[model samples]
Target chain A: MNDQEIIEQIKKGDESAIDFLYKKNYRMMVKLILKNSGTEDEAKDIYQDALVVLWQKARNPEFVLSSKISTYLYSVCLNLWRKELERKGRHTSSEGMDYGENMPYDEKERIHIVQKCINELGDACKQILIYYYYDKLSMAEIAEKMGFANADTAKTKKYKCKQELDKKIKTQYTPSDFLD
Target chain B: MELQEKIDQYLLDQLSPADKTKFEQLIAGDSHLKSEVALQQSVVTALGNTRSMQLKARMQKIPVSMASTGNALRLKWIGIATTGAVAAGLIIFFLTGTGQEKNTESAESSSIQQTTSTEISPAVVPTIESTTPSAESQTEKAEQAVVVKKQKNTGTVAPSNEIKAFDNSANFDDIENGNVTTPNAENSSAPANTLYTETNNKLSNLSVTVDNSNSKDKSYQFTGSKLTLFGDFNNKPYELLELNNKGQKNLFLSYNNEYYELVWGQMKKTPLKKVSHKETLEKLKVINP
Candidate 1:
């Protein structure tokens, strides 16, 4: 079944939907966890936690998945695993946390402010920024995926969105605010 | 170009080397410019983290299930639910605990089998001698013996021990029951037959018996590069050994569910099927003989 259909079945509390989801992703999830310093049992546990989170989100009527179900699940699992690693004080270098260690308080606050600004930039700009900065997609690729006329159009839009984000960030708080 | 655009390019490393050097100089000269670059870098890092979190969450939404028998399938679901609850609690505890406590807790949890020898048989007693042959290791040997005694009393059985040893000179019945005496056994005047028993524990425990009578070479060595398909673990077939074609003596020992590929007594993790102790010993005999 398709992702939407699976979501509908889950919303209807169909057990088979849950089974279907588990059977489809178990191997990949297990491999991902195993390669990331997790044992077999730990992989199983993380998979289940991710499923539970998906179930809860599916059950909510207001919850909308803008991305594919697999994409959403992957993100959730990655977040959970990173949090897990952080909690355990295990090395996170493998997960691209080179700058995470010994981050200054002001730098952290600045990032937090920037994140808030990005969040307020509306879904379109947020997605574009994520696609450009996070996903590392080329402007042409982002334009094609996001349904823009051309790469140049996407570039201009991204610049404007970034400017708006920067403006919001600067207006939200001063450096002195972080000192307090 | 606007300073903001230049800063973005600088953060992304899109600037030419000369431009980057100039930007660095500018930042070094101006505290305001330095702070701006740092803030922009932080922004990029934050966005990267946000994207990572999103991607991880999406990947996790995929379904997972284990292969199981008819009645066992039902139990598997029940086990999943139960374990999920337990895992949730553990995650909370891990998050709340201090860093040192978390490390201690994780260490204790992983070594639970070592501390609690309730069900599994002591399968490594024979292999331990070949692996660590120092006078200072008497305490570890005694501990292993105690574990074996406890396993013997519990009446746990291993499928691996059922296979007879390959030594034509030794009685099949005696070897099958792990009643063969080693040189150490003879020297110490003690019976040194290594017995194996299977347990439901996922931890791998394997022991190999070296036939030292032929060479008087107290140390056993394995020389093979091709791993042979020997047996299965939970129905998953795995190639257990890569035999050295040159006929070099090598020690093949499996302990605690880990295959130690010892090349000249230096241990390295080898990718091999988790097999019964009997299978490993039999394979060792085949390679050596």
Candidate 2:
């Protein structure tokens, strides 16, 4: 499909279009990262991240892509890899490197606990939260997708899911229980 | 619930200027509100990380890693080349006629073969007279073939129950090397009682026509796998038909309205022999219907 057709399908949240976009640009994106001294795994991660960004942006009704989709994806990958290189300190000497490279023990523990809590949530609650926060889909779109009667039903469900998740996460947040 | 929504709004940066300023002031003043917003921010961050991981995992599952993709493209090229060679061989096989007829007739037809010539007395001369190509051209068609209903005599006359399908009495030499024009070719699906059993090496390049005349224009086609030749028998459309009787396989082609038997195995060695063509084709149309 042409760029506009792929854009339209992605806007409608077509899963195949995401797969198509990912495969069609995989080699080019990977080559970019490899030429910049990134490993294959690192290249795949950066490219997938860029494609996810495209998926999230295309679903926004107000978003207008002015250039070819390939050009936009190429630019996103380039910018993202540059940031990665800077973070790794590969662009400069490591003489002034600090111990701030690793995540704090407490923060990592909290993140693990949060992921477990999210997984323990019921399917509907989990999907509603992801759709709202990560996918950034509007309430009406969620209603149609989740087969709720209307936007109000979807909103009400999101509120309940968030409250349940908060309760779940709070109950698991004792540092003494996870003192490793 | 109201406080919780405000905390979510502040964490997501979705609150307006006035609401954001008020919420920040509240966060600075109250330690509990600040901790609540911090807890919520961590949850949203983790959610994004988990989703991104899942999407990447899905992409890795898609088919054909780069290492294997190159091999698949090479294999496809090899397959195309093999098919082209097979088609070229068949075109050369049909354009040049092989050897003449050799008797592979089974015991059933041979037992009645001696009776056929004896039964063809002076009275049967009038019956054979009507067996000429001009007489049968009225009902002749290129796609039409016969079933082995008249297998009694490999020579000519059929018994009472036997149905004669071809007019085999045409002059063999005149039919083979004559100035003949082919009929309009028609193609049809192979019926349950099909005339030709596909060769283990099925000649799909059947577009080659017999070059009896000087012009190299090809009018013969195996139209849709039916072994029909759309060539001329004196301006009439002539067809080739395959007849299977008992354990024997017989292939026939026509020129000047006279049918020549194309011996199966001896194709390269056998000359084109004038034999049973019309009577067998007539029965083939009956059985196919």
Candidate 3:
């Protein structure tokens, strides 16, 4: 199908639409990265990131695609790859900044604990949390995506999921998990 | 707003700067709001990570063909380069086999260059003998002919009197216009110059070989489009050899007892750079390309 139809399917959360886009643009997008000094795995990673970005943006009702989906994906891949290369350069040059060691011990523990708590959440709650907090979707958009009755229902569910995740993490929290 | 909504607004950075400052002060005073915001921040970061992992997993599972455009483009990049020698050989091959009249006149011309010819492989020997035309019959036709003088035509260049072709562009133009005369050649009476027009049977006769073919003897042919001289002989005939060295195809011309490298131009006449370098001339002298 054409860009509009595929976009509409994505807006409707059609998995097949994602599959179609993933297959159709896979070669050219990956080839772009491969030509620009990226390895196959790196190319695949960048293209996937670009696709996810597009998929997330397509969920916004007000998001107008000013270009073809492929063009949008290509631009996204290029920018992401540039950022990735910059990150790699910085990572290589900044030898003393070991990321895990640099972070506060408690903060690292908190992230680990929070990630574990998040994993315990049901798939729907996880999707809702990601849609709102990560993808920055509005409550209404979350409601539409999660098949909630309304924005209020989506909001209540999100708050409850957060509370559940917080409770799970708080149970695991100890004096040692906090800095003095 | 409910405390949770207030906290959500602050956590999402949706609050105005003044409101955010006010909320930060309130949270600073209220440990509970501060704890809630911190908890939510960690959750957001974790959720983002989780979503990325999920999306990445899904993408990695998507099957792509191994023989996709990536490899195709790579192969195309390799295809971008064609060495100058192979290209020039192609040019010489096509330009030399154009005239039908050149084939008929081959019996006279082909034999004249044999003694001084480089090693002639069966494949490179053009089927010029297939087309035989009379010297007198092809007098007018000789002007547009493509000529090749094979090794068998060695007698055409008698060792008794050495022949020196016209050394200048004006004379080269005379040769190009078929104004040269062999005893049996009906083209010219301008002395010394012989029209050696030998046409191969098929234009598909192309070779990508080395220069060692012109190792010994003196035989050369200056015909329609190009002049190829082979072997080393006493007369030191002005012979032009299309030599493919390294990846470059260069024309090393021996004319008027001097060696010059010819650079082809858009027009009929091209400038020849004189080669006084002994090593290069000796090297060129040995190549029977």
Candidate 4:
């Protein structure tokens, strides 16, 4: 069933509706939570809380659909994961971690080398790059999250970071450079 | 754009299709551009890989804290409106007590007991201003205004309104009160009663829709939870409907103009039972009818 249909069934207290929802999104939810520094249990807890929230909102007649269910779910999971990180008093540097199972062998090695190069680059460059690319956060989100002046400022910083990375890579040339 | 600018735009997937083609052509013809593009790409790829690993490793060490105290969550909700109601009641009790005592003293001091108009006025004001009793009336007016505005704007009423309760405030009040009432005052409540009063009645409609869906044919029976609608902890249990459907099931519950949906799946049986969505009507429903 579509999300709306499932949501309708769930409102009526249908058990199967809950089952179907869990099955469809559990894998992606787990992956998302794990990527946000959540363990398997944390992922499960956040996912469960998200489900309850969904259920509560579904029962509330006032809430209108503004986006796809998956997007909403992902947003909730992300928020919860971020909260988890904050509660632990740890800063998440999700930089240089390989979570993409779909990466090709050559691409993976090249990526590793590029990551090393980035590490060699300044910390500012690394943070900007991670904020923009790996997090897939919008310039606005990044600006707000990182305390940038504005989206324009964040974009400028990102541009400078990219330039620095490029400059560093040019200085250190290797034929099998990607393989390192 | 400069070569660096073009390369940056290309890496970010911001270049137009035509620009992308031009850039690709330029890179193919020039070994220098190719090398530059490869180097830039490598940096991005490496960052992506590193971030993913970091996130994964971080997740491994981190344990999920409970978002809320689950033990309190269910009961807390069950008592939500009741807590509010209890608080309001206490405030009213104190105010009325003080007012009555003052009125008695005034009567003793100066024989003015015909009405005690000021004292009575304050007591009534609290009842009205508390927002518990008069919410329906205000909600009704707001809904009417919205309907009129929508009709004027669109020149038509939506089809869903045919199924939806036109008198939302009244129906909400009735539902919250636990009255087997229908939204239609003009049309008899008999039809809606048949629809909601029996498990068999709702099943026929749900089953027909489920049977027609494209999924594989499978029959399963599972008990559903009904909303608890009482203030007192002790109340007779009401049996919830058992849903047997193929599609992803979501149970929608409405209370006091608010709506909630509960979703669960792959369950041997329903996990949650008789959750109150924190509505005053539930208290009324259990008490009045």
TM score of chain A per candidate: 0.49, 0.70, 0.67, 0.48
Identify the superior model by DockQ, candidate 3 or candidate 4: 3
lDDT of 1 at B282: 46
Interface RMSD of 4: 22.8
Instruction: Please write out the lDDT profile of model 4 over residues B181-238, one tens digit for every residue.
Output: 3323223111111112121222222321122132232222233421222222111111
Enumerate the candidates' DockQ scores in order. Answer: 0.08, 0.06, 0.08, 0.07
Q: Pick the candidate with the highest lDDT.
A: 3
Least well predicted 10-residue stretch by lDDT in candidate 3 chain A = A92-101
Candidate 1: share of reference interface contacts reproduced: 0.14
Model 1 spans with C-alpha error above 4 angstroms: A1-101, A175-180, B66-289
Local accuracy of candidate 4 as per-residue lDDT tens digits, A27-130: 44665555444566767766655554465455444454443454345445544444445444442442222224456877666666666678786776687787
Off by over 4 Å in 3: A1-18, A55-69, A83-109, A136-156, A174-180, B13-18, B28-32, B66-289
Question: For each candidate, what TM-score against the reference?
Answer: 0.38, 0.47, 0.44, 0.35
Ten contiguous residues minimizing lDDT sum, candidate 2 chain A: A91-100
TM-score of 1: 0.38
Model 3 iRMS (Å) reads 30.1
lDDT of 1 at A109: 69
Please give, for residues B111-208, the per-residue lDDT of candidate 2 as tens digits: 22111211122121222211110111111111111123111111122122222222223332222222111110001110111122222122222322
Best candidate per TM-score, number? Answer: 2
Interface root-mean-square deviation, each candidate: 21.9, 33.8, 30.1, 22.8
Error of 3 at A143 (Å): 4.8
